[model samples]
Target: MNSRIVLGAFALTALVACKEKENKNIVEEIIEIEEVQPTTYAEISVKEGGSWKEGTREYIDGSFVNVDEMEVPEQHTDHSWYIRYEGPGWENKQTAYRLYLDWRNAIDIFGKKVDTLVLPYVGTDGFDSYHNEAPWGQDILKAGQSMGIGGYGRFTGDTIAHFNEVEKTHVKVDNSNSSSSVTIDYKGWKTGDVTTDLESVISIFPEDRFLKAELTPSVSFDGLATGIVKFDDIPLMQETSETGEWAYIATYGVQTLAGENDKLGMAIFYKTDEAKAIEGPHDHLVVFNPSTKTQTYYINSAWDQEKGGIKSEEAFKKDLQTKLSELDNNGKLE
Candidate 1:
């Protein structure tokens, strides 16, 4: 009886030791995952600590402060200087992007050199500091009079009508460990004769240079389009995925604002069925079919100066093809 009791006690002791070891292993694994997890960021900042010029469209004498949501003041327009970076900015490890948030309503890319969150630090030094090349990156695209890459507007035959006549504009931002997004609500957006409300959600994931835009218009009308900005001597490239479910409109050449020699590639991926036509006179446009339902599309860019980035047109095309295949196989790019 004494021997049996001693053996039972020894067995219990061994079992407890084994359980403790297992628990310790799990704790270590959790710590490892927490340390290496990716991060994404999004934010909108406005001038504070100063007063808005009374009866004028100006914000004077204040520093920028980050905000979660904002109602665009009635007197805002391009280079108004009230909003930092001129609008909401978002970024993942690969790249960063921002919208004009004013009459231009155009999208722009911020080429990144490091693989970390940098949007919060951007434009903090000054409004125009980002235009020049820095250690992180620079405002690489010259949008000009076009919808900077994947920015939407109403196609009115010979012209693309931007958000020039919106009654009000509201913007909100969301950020998480896995993704970051900006939601813009345009109330009473007037383009030509048609007036409708629009909600544009632009989101970026933790691993890629592509940002997804999901547009939902309150009323259905024709000629809703998104496109890449046009540049001289840079030819547009278009192709359908192997599965034929996805297609892309792209351009690659010495087009970045960084310099005449700096190469940048921009592309828009859309569902083949949702696209009504691919037309271009001002910008490389992808006109979507008329519907009240939410329409989805993606905008991507690659800068030659980025760390481990695509340097050649051939590699850019190859990377786009891989993304197409991923989209075709999984119904989404992971």
Candidate 2:
């Protein structure tokens, strides 16, 4: 009788344990991570572990894991200038920005969708025919940034010098990941005689209104300015950190798609404990006194017609405040 009782209790305990295990299994089956969705694919300039001679590339599905690729978009060229245009030249489904490798340290703007440029345009060559529809964004940022639209420049305590500021190295790109990015190599750009060794990685996404600039310098450098062309007619609106570690500058007024008399907002953003003072150089400059070798900043724009936000000065300022907060919150769900 005693042995039978002991066996019955053992059986009861086993049954309970089994039932608990079964319930746990059911809960696990209900919880699973959904896979991420794929966006537009990328096929970048030949500069990525390849030769520069190739002009365009066909889109390969997993060929690029990132949504932003270079080769997939329409690219205008001045091949009449070079054998191969190994531009850090890049365009997304919505916008275009290219490196004038032969021109200067400047990055030229090609604002519209490449498809739009397919239409007719100005002065033809010796052939007297319409050459190509010019880049609608046309270098809207004229001496705005000598390094050519965010390229590094030497602040000679006077005028900025960008000529021969970057490495002769061909532009290198990485579109392999789901997000497309381009890198321009520089040992360090010189201003007068001061040279800071650093390489810049610029990455962009399909839905992003801005691109991020990741700068790695071999040594600490200061007073680097990221700016835009200043028009006496357009008003500049911005704010600086009381602590001098962060800054935001923007111009909202007559700047627009193709520089027409429409509304556009161009801005630069940076944050670091090393920032010293923000000043208006030839155009606009956010000065930073570096405490570390790695620095990150952002440059972007919004066209009242393209992106659906902040057309008025009041709205634009509010958006900037919100963006700063979002960045501060580690990109939280707020």
lDDT, each prediction:
0.85, 0.48
Name the best candidate (by TM-score): 1
lDDT of 2: 0.48
Per candidate, the number of residue pairs that clash is: 0, 12
Compose the digit string of candidate 2's lDDT tens values, residues 91-202. Answer: 4444445554432555544444342321112111211122233444332344434443454454556665554544334345554324556765555456655676656677
* Model 1 root mean square deviation, Cα atoms: 10.8
- Residue-level lDDT of model 1, residues 224-254, one tens digit each, is 9999999889998998998799999999999
lDDT score for residue 210 of model 2: 64
Residue pairs with backbone overlap in model 1 = none
How does model 1 fare in lDDT? 0.85
Quote the lDDT for 252 in model 1. 95
